[model samples]
Target: MKSAELNYPTQQQELLAIVHALAAFRMYYLDEPPIVETDHKSLEGLFTQKMANRRLARWYDILAEYQPTFPICPERRTASLMH
Candidate 1:
């Protein structure tokens, strides 16, 4: 497997990028479903919840574009890896 690094100015943008990155990673690397590791657990809930903001709505639309079927798992022990 390969990994990529991304930088964002805001937490919200970073979260959206993470969802995009994980979907890309799964499409490029795994044949079976892949589990994404994220530092923010709130994003897991946010992705499933209805969007209230325009930016969030746009981000959600980008996330939905991937048709991602994999699950997202919050980092259990090493949270600094992504940062």
Candidate 2:
């Protein structure tokens, strides 16, 4: 899905993307801890953020179930691929 199509805030949008991708491929990665690679380094500290809203808190809880690992990748190196 396109980011423009999502009405959520930028941070929420990022989290939603991860959630959607994981849900769509749950069968293939459910049994194993999935490695989530992203150009957005902020995602690596997503759960550590002090969520001021319930929505973000809820999203954090949902993510806890997957036990995902976020590896920091330089955006410039992955810029073209992101497009």
Candidate 3:
């Protein structure tokens, strides 16, 4: 990660990964609603509501095109999930 990107919070990185994946698999996402399964519970709210972080806000705009659904698994908790 570049120095400019090193300061992003955990949630921001998670969202970044999602954005990258969406862009990488644009063809597949274009046809159907992508399901993003993550342990980060906050991501649901991050995308659903307005984001304060400029970086996140930008990624949110990118995500709007995919119209993905975050069905965060109830079984896996963020604290317990290992990086």
Candidate 4:
């Protein structure tokens, strides 16, 4: 279950990736909370944001169904590890 979406804001793209991953693997990890690791640290505050934006609100609603723990993955560290 791999995917890519074009022409979205950086935040939206990050959220989309989480949505896709959860949808793809929901059956295996539905009962257990999923650990979502990413370089996007701002995502840690996603649910706390004011949902004035409809798109973000909808995305938040979609995400509320699962228990997700976001672990910060520093971009520099990830890039270095990939080398």
Q: Which candidate is the best by lDDT?
A: 3
**Residues 7-56 of candidate 2: C-alpha lDDT, one tens digit per residue:** 77676688888888887887887789889877776675666769878877
Ranking by lDDT: 3, 4, 2, 1
lDDT of 4 by residue, 28-68 (tens): 78679888888877776776778858878877777778877
Candidate 2's TM-score reads: 0.78
How high is each candidate's TM-score? Answer: 0.51, 0.78, 0.77, 0.79
Which of the numbered candidates is closest to the native, going by highest TM-score?
4
Candidate 3's residue-wise lDDT over 1-83, tens digit each? 56766678888877887889899999987678999888778876776676686777788789888899888877546556755
Worst 10 residues of 4 by lDDT: 1-10
**Candidate 2 global lDDT:** 0.78
Q: What's the CA error at residue 49 for candidate 3, in Å?
A: 4.1
RMSD of each: 6.3, 2.8, 2.9, 3.0
Candidate 1 lDDT by residue in tens digits, 1-83: 12333343345655666666766675564454444555655665666777767868876676555555535555655566546
* Winner by lDDT between candidate 4 and candidate 1: 4
Task: Score candidate 4 by lDDT.
Answer: 0.79
Residue pairs with backbone overlap in model 3: none
Off by over 4 Å in 1: 1-11, 19-34, 69-76, 80-83
Off by over 4 Å in 4: 1-5
Off by over 4 Å in 2: 1-5
